[model samples]
Target chain A: MTLVGLAARNVLRNKFRAALTVAGVAVAIITFLLLRTVLWAWTAAADYAAKDRVVTRHKVTFIMTLPLSYAQSVRSLPQVKASTFCNWFGGKDPKHDKEFFGSLACDTETGFTVYDDMVVPPDVLDQWKHDAQGAIVGDVIAKKMNWKVGDRVTLQTGIYPKEGDWEFRISGIYQAKSKAVDRSTFIFHWKYLNDNLPANRKDQIGWIVSRVHDPSQAAGVGVAIDKVFDEKEIQTLSQDERAFNASFLASISAVLTAINIISVVILVIMALVLGNTIAMGVRERTNEYGVLKALGFSNKHVVMFIVVEAIVIGVAGGLLGLAIGYPFIEGGLGRFLEENMGSFFPYFKIDPRMSVLAMFLAVALAAAASVIPAISAARLKTVDALKRIA
Target chain B: MDTATEKAPASHRDKAEALVSLRGIVKIYERGGEQLKILDGLDLEIAKGSYEALMGPSGSGKSTLLNLIAGLDRPTAGSIDIGGKRIDQLNESQLARWRADTIGFIFQSYNLMPVLTAVENVELPLLLTKVPSSERRQRAQTALRVVGLEDRMDHFPRQLSGGQEQRVAIARAIVNDPALIVADEPTGDLDRKSADDILGILEQLNRELGKTIVMVTHDPAAAERAKVIRRLDKGQLK
Candidate 1:
């Protein structure tokens, strides 16, 4: 028999203990995958932001607005390819109060060009631009609310408190080119908000999304745009779209940190469970180890035997967890996140990298769990070990 | 240094001359921080092919004496010379190497690795040597054949009966053709018929193969098969 075969057999000496250890590792891998997915989603906004796009908002807060005249000034720049403005509708469906999505009042003609990654068919784009009271919804948002073509939907905006309600016709449904982006946004014509506003609030814009000639020149153009508006009464904070997303993520950084801490706790629990099982097995087979040593096997061999046993347990557990975990996330968690938190997570399936990392961790943790047991086994003297009964 | 060791036995090629000599040996153990002397000064001479038995009571330090001769435990004080080399002066790792090369042991209870088959258990000792994998297997099969267990080479220790397991253990011990064979109560756990058969096998290993045998046992029937009988009481041999 091979040395590895002996180790594998010894690991199965206590069937229940080996099974428990595999279960522990599987649970840890699941927790680790869940936390990693949250971290990935949180950081995806930063990773997938448009490189040639710059956003200018009110210096004090995004809650305030800029003048429509600022768009005219920004469009005048030589490096500026296109410029569009959008105001947050802060609108919610009265029926599904908890279901959130991006509701924006944007320049229908220029908004589509500036945010080209938010791709829609030519017919839908033309239809959306031609109809003034038309609102185009994302396909994911359409599916969730079960809205159809030519459907009239009313949105209640708390920010722009209206006389009764604001109504718009569903003109088109848009999809995201990149999975990093949410496909659940509802974009309406900016003129609708402007027409409903009082004369004092008219012509006010929430934020400007400007596409630059080159991604490398985006920062310089952003600076120049902010400089042009610096002389005005309202100041601006101009940054690349990625930095804008990072700032939003920073607001919920604490929650991400908590998930990370809990994930490490799960690893510790896995280590403890695996370590305890190894220790017990080693203790029971102390005399057998002495017998091996008496037969001229070195301490290194003894340690290798134990470590090999742990690795087998770890690999088995990791595979079992992946077997269960893939469907659990994709079929169960994936469906829930896409339906409820579509604004934040348009696609919530497990990434290939996350699955690989989980498998690697299982093997590493299995070997790591045996470290103490191996050392203890090596430290035992032949006479003392032989003296140990059972 | 004693001339009497040469006259003991000169029977076979494995033991053409005297190899190991013990002058004085003692072993002491510390338990619960209290010193307990297990073996006092004892002297024994063993030649190359002598088959001798050491008979003793439970407290007679027979196992302790066997451990010292096998180079497994260090004597508190004394010189143990084996194969013209002083074993007591050697380090623990060096002693282990020496034992692996020159000494073989069969315990009262068969100590074969439970996971291994009879052939694999026999091959374990050859792993310490520089033998190739194929040669190790060949040598293990040859040793199993010598013990009349070639048919059971593929059987695990658990699958073997008491006597067959003992035979496998013997095969593992002699797989390297060790010059010295030490059996401590080798037949104590077996019934009379099996014990007699095991003794018969040991007799063949000694008379035919010329292997020097040092056995410690409480059974007079086992000791009667040996050429010489030595009795130990307390720590001294009489």
Candidate 2:
């Protein structure tokens, strides 16, 4: 038999311990993949943001508003192909009060044009344009809230307190063509929200989004738009869509950093578990190594036996981890997050590259962990090793 | 060196050349701040094609001498020549290579790889050689047959009786066709019937196959099977 074959057989000498080590490695792999998937999904919005679009918000904070005239000024820019403005409605359905989603009052004329990745059918868009009280919901939110066309829904909000709950008819459901688009949003015309507001709050907009003629020149266009508002009563801060999304992510950078650190800690734990198993196996087989040495095997051969055994356990655990992790993360948890937490984790599926990296790390770290034990076994004197009982 | 070494028949001693020769062997071990000398300056020789047994009580250095002769160990100070090569002067790796090519070892516990089958255990020594896999298997099967264990070739060491395991170990030792076989208490763990059976195989290996052997044993009955017997006491021949 080959030396490798013999070493593989030795792995089964303590079947229970081998199984436990493999299980430990598998659990670590799963935890690592879960943390990595969270980090990937969290940054996905920034990663997939449109390069050609720029957002202009109040310079001080998003809580304040800009005059509706600012939307016209942004549209008048030479580099701006189209522009849209929206105010955060902060509206929640009275029926499902606990469920959270994006609610926005957007300019009907340019909303779909600037945010082109929000796909709505022509018939539905035509119908919504004619109805002042009609609303267009995302397909995800529509399914979540059981809203269908022609259904009247009432929303309550603390920010926009009115005489009664706001009411609107469901006009259409939009599907997202890009991962950056939140699939759980509710959108209605800005004019409807404007006409219902008090005199002090009327004609005020939250933010303006403009699509540039050249994506590469988006940064220059953003500077030009902010320059237009420099002398205005309310100053504006303008950035490209990618930068806007990145700033939002930077706010929670600590959480992401913690997840990354936890991923590394899990890998270290896996290595320690693997290393301990290898050390114990080497200790138990000290006498067998002496027999091998006396039978003419070199020190290198003894090391090979130990390293090969560890490699077998490592690879087995990796395959098993992938087998369980793929479905557990992709099929079950991904679906739940996409349906419920779409605003935060719009795309929650596991990254194929991360899976490959996890498997590679399993084998590499396991071999690395076995280094001390393999060296100790190789350096053992044949006579001294033979003196040990087992 | 006086009368401690008893001479065999002159006819037997004069007919063969020396296959193993040791001069001024000294083995010292440091244990808990004290230097314990296991073997003092000693000299000995074994003729080619000889079957000799080394007998002594515990701590007599019989096993140490056998280990030195087998190249499984190095003497602190000595010149050990086996098959005309100075083994004591060779490095650890070089001695390992030399042992693979020249010496086979049998231990009291059989020392068979519990994970491997009888045939696989026999094939262990040949794995170091450039022999093709098919040839290694054939040689292993033939070795097991010589030990009368062809039917148990696929059995693991744990599945076999103590006597059968020892035979498997013997098959492993002779599988590579080494020039010398050194067995340390080969029959120590076996019953009287099993011990006799093992001794008969050792006799067959020495007589029929003409293999030279040096064995260390505490049992005189086991030593009597050899052609020549030497007694050791306090690390010196008696």
Candidate 3:
């Protein structure tokens, strides 16, 4: 038998204990992968953000609105190719109160132009532009609510109170071409919303999104836009889309940090489980190690046997984790999260590189964990070891 | 035993070259902050191809002496020359190589790997050498055949009787054709029939293969089969 073959056979000497250790390591790997996927999904918005786009909002809070006149000033900038303004409708269907989705009242003409990644047919765009109360719903929301193009729907809003429910015609359905964009939004005309409001609130818009000619200069253009309103009654905060997404993520940084810490803790737990198993095996096989020494195998050979056994266990556990994790995360939980929490997790999928990294960590940590046991086994006196009965 | 009739004369043994020579050997172990000497300044020699048995009571340093001769442990002080090589001067790794080339071992508990089959256990020592896989298997089979356990080559240690397991251990020891074969209590755990079987195998290995065999045992019946039986009491040969 080969030395490696001998080491591998030793792993099966106590099948039940080895199986339990392997299962424990598999669980740790799954937990680590799940936490890493959460972190990855959270940062995916920023990673896929459009570089050519800038968002301008209130300096103090996103809840506050900018003056409607600010949209014109943003559009007039030389670097800006197009611009649009939208207000958060915060509307919900009374029939499905528990279901959450994004609702926005946007400038019908410029909304479609600024959000070029939102794909709508020419006929549908024409129909939406002419109708004052026309709405464009995302395919995901359309499928969820079972709303058709010609169907009329009513929504109740908490932000903008009305005497009765607001009504709109579903003029079109839109799909997202980029992962950064949510596929579950209800977009309607800002004019329809403003015309019904009192004079004091009529000319207020929530935010402005502008597409710039040069992506590299988008941040500079955002600075110029904020500078225009710096001395006005209300100040504006402007940033490129990626920085804007990052700022939003910073508000929930604590949750992300917890996930990161949990991921590391899982790896530590995996190492402990692996190390304990190897140590136990070494203790139980003390007499066998002595016998090997008597057969002229050196201390280095003894160390190799223990370390290789641990590595095999680690790799086996890693494969088991991957087999269970890929289906559960990418296929099962990912679909549920994308459907239910599309605004927070626009794209929920496992990163292929992360899978490879998890496997690599499993083997590396297993080897690291085996170090103490290997040394202990190698340092045993041959005569003393042979005297013990295992 | 039939093989005892083939034992060489004392003059023939004296004329043969010495396979092992020890000069002023000493071993000390520290316990509770005090030095405990196991083997004193002892000197001995054994001719090549001799079958000898060492018998001693508990704590008589019989096992320690065997360990020293096999290069499994270093002496606190002295020189050991085995198979024309000065083993006392060799470092740990060099001594391992030397032992691999010159020494084979059998244990009372039949220290065959539980995970490996009989043939696989025998093939273990060959992994240290540059032997090809096919030739290693063939040599291991041949060794098992020499021990008359070729039919049990595929059996695991747990599947075999005590006598059969010890035979496999013997096969593993001789697979590399070392110059010296050292057995510690080779039949200490066996029934009388099994013990006699093991003793007969040792005698046949000495006579047919001409391998020098040094065995440490507590059983006088086991020692009686050896051509030369030496006794030790309190670290001195008697």
Candidate 4:
């Protein structure tokens, strides 16, 4: 038999312990992949942001608003291709109070043009443009609320206090063409919201969104637009779409840091589990190593036996983890998140590189874990090792 | 003075040339800051094709001397020449190679790899050599046949009796066709019947195949089978 074959057979000598160790490594691998996927999905929005779009909001906070005239001024810039503005509605359906989704009041004429990733049927778009109180709902929200075209939906808002609930007709159900777009948003006409607002709030807008002619010049265009309002009564913070998403992510940087630390901790736990198994195996086989040495095998050969055994366990555990992890993440949890939490994780599938990395880490950590045991086994005196009972 | 040029006694020269020669052998081990000398300065010689047995009480250094001759351990101060090669001067790796090519070992416990079959255990030593896989298997089968355990070649150690396991270990020792066979209490763990069977095999190997055998044993019955019996007490030959 080959030396590697001998090492592999030794791993199966204590079947129950080896199986338990493999299971431990597999569980660690699954936890690692799950945390990594969460981190990846959280940052996917910034990674997939549209380069040509820039957002202009209040310098101090997103809660404050800019004047409606600021939209026209942004559109008048030489570099701006199209401009639109939206205000957060904070609308809730009384029927599904616990269900959370995004609601926005947007400019009807320029909203679809600036946010081009949202696809609506031409007939529905026409209806939404013509009707004063018409709204376009995303397909995910439409399915959840069971709303059809021409359905009358009433929403209660915490931001704007009206005499009664606001009413609108569902003119369109939109679908997202990119992962950057939330698939569960409700968009209505900003004019409908502005006309009903009190005199002081009538001319206010939440944020202005503009598309640039050249994506590479988006930063320069943002600077020029902010210059327009630099000395005005209200200063604006302008950024490209990616930078806007990054700033939003920075608000919860602690959560991201925790996920990162937890992912590394899982890898450390995997190494420990592998190391314990290898050390135990080496201890039990001390006499066998002596026998090998007496049979003209060197210390290097003893080290090989222990290291190869650890690596075999590592490979087996890695394969088992991937087998369970892929379906669990992509098929089960991913579908649930995309349906329920699409605002945060629009696309929640596992990345292929993550799978490769998990396998690589498993094997690498297994080898690293075996180092001390392998060296100890190699340094043992042949006569002393032969005297061991096992 | 170089021990290689030292003249041998007339009686040893009258027999076949010496296969193993030791001069001024001393082994010391330091434990907990105290030096314990196991084998004091000693000298011995074993001729080729001779069957010799080493006998002593506990802590008499018989095993230590056997280990020194087998190249399994080094002497703190001594010269060991086995099969015309100065083994005491060899490094750990070179000694391992030398042991593989020149000496076969049979332990008291029948230290067969529990994971490997009898034939595989026999073939293990050949892995370190340049022998082809097919030839290695053929040679292992031949060695098992020589020990009259050819039928049990595919059985694992746990499946075999103690006597049969010892036979398998013997097969492993002879599979490489080394010049010297060093056995440490080969029959220590066997019953009287099984021990007799193992001793008979060793006798046949020496008489029929002309293989030199050096064994360490406590049983007087086991020692009587050898052509020459040497006794050691407190690190000195008696």
Give the CA lDDT, 0 to 100, for residue A297 in model 2: 89
Give candidate 1 misplaced runs (Cα > 4 Å): B1-16
Q: What is the lDDT of residue A61 in candidate 1?
A: 95
lDDT of 4 at A218: 94
Query: Candidates' TM-scores?
Result: 0.92, 0.97, 0.97, 0.95
- Model 2 over residues B1-238: C-alpha lDDT tens digits? 2423434677777788999999999998889999989889878888888898999899989999998999988899989999999998888899889999999888999999888999999999999999999999999999999999989999998899999999999999999999999999999999999999999999999999989999999998999999888887787777
Top-down TM-score ranking: 3, 2, 4, 1
Consecutive 10-residue window with the lowest summed lDDT within model 2 chain A: A334-343
Per residue, candidate 4 scores C-alpha lDDT tens digits across A190-282 of: 999999998988989999999999999999988999999999999999999999988989998999999999999999988987998899889
Writing each residue's lDDT as its tens digit, candidate 1 over B1-238 gives 2322232333542344656677767788889999887778778777677887887889889888887788777889888988788989987678778888988889887877776788999998888898888999999999999989989999988899999999988988899899889898999999999899899999999989989999998998998898667778888877
lDDT for predicted candidate 3 compared with the true structure: 0.90
Q: Name the candidate, 1 or 3, with the larger TM-score value.
A: 3
Question: What local lDDT does model 1 show for residue B220?
Answer: 89
DockQ of candidate 1, scored on C-alphas against the true complex (2 decimals): 0.47
Model 1 lDDT tens row, A1-390: 567777888777778878878887887887788777767766776778899999999999988999898888888999899999999998988877877988999997899899888888899889888888899888888999988879989888888987978988999888888766787898999999899998998999999999999999888988999999888999898899999888888898898889889887887778778888888889988988877777767778899999999999888988888888878877888778876787776777777898897888788887998999988987898767777877
Question: Which residue pairs in candidate 4 collide?
Answer: none
**Per-residue C-alpha lDDT of model 3 across residues A265-288, encoded as one tens digit per residue:** 999988988998899889989999
Report the lDDT tens digits of candidate 2 across residue range A37-144. 999999988989999999999999878999999999999989999999999999999889889888999999889988889999989999999999899998888998
CAPRI level of candidate 2: high
**Which is better, 3 or 4, measured by DockQ?**
3
iRMS values for every prediction: 1.9, 0.8, 1.0, 0.7
Residue-level lDDT of model 4, residues B81-155, one tens digit each, is 998999999988998888889889999999999989999999999999999999999999999999999899899
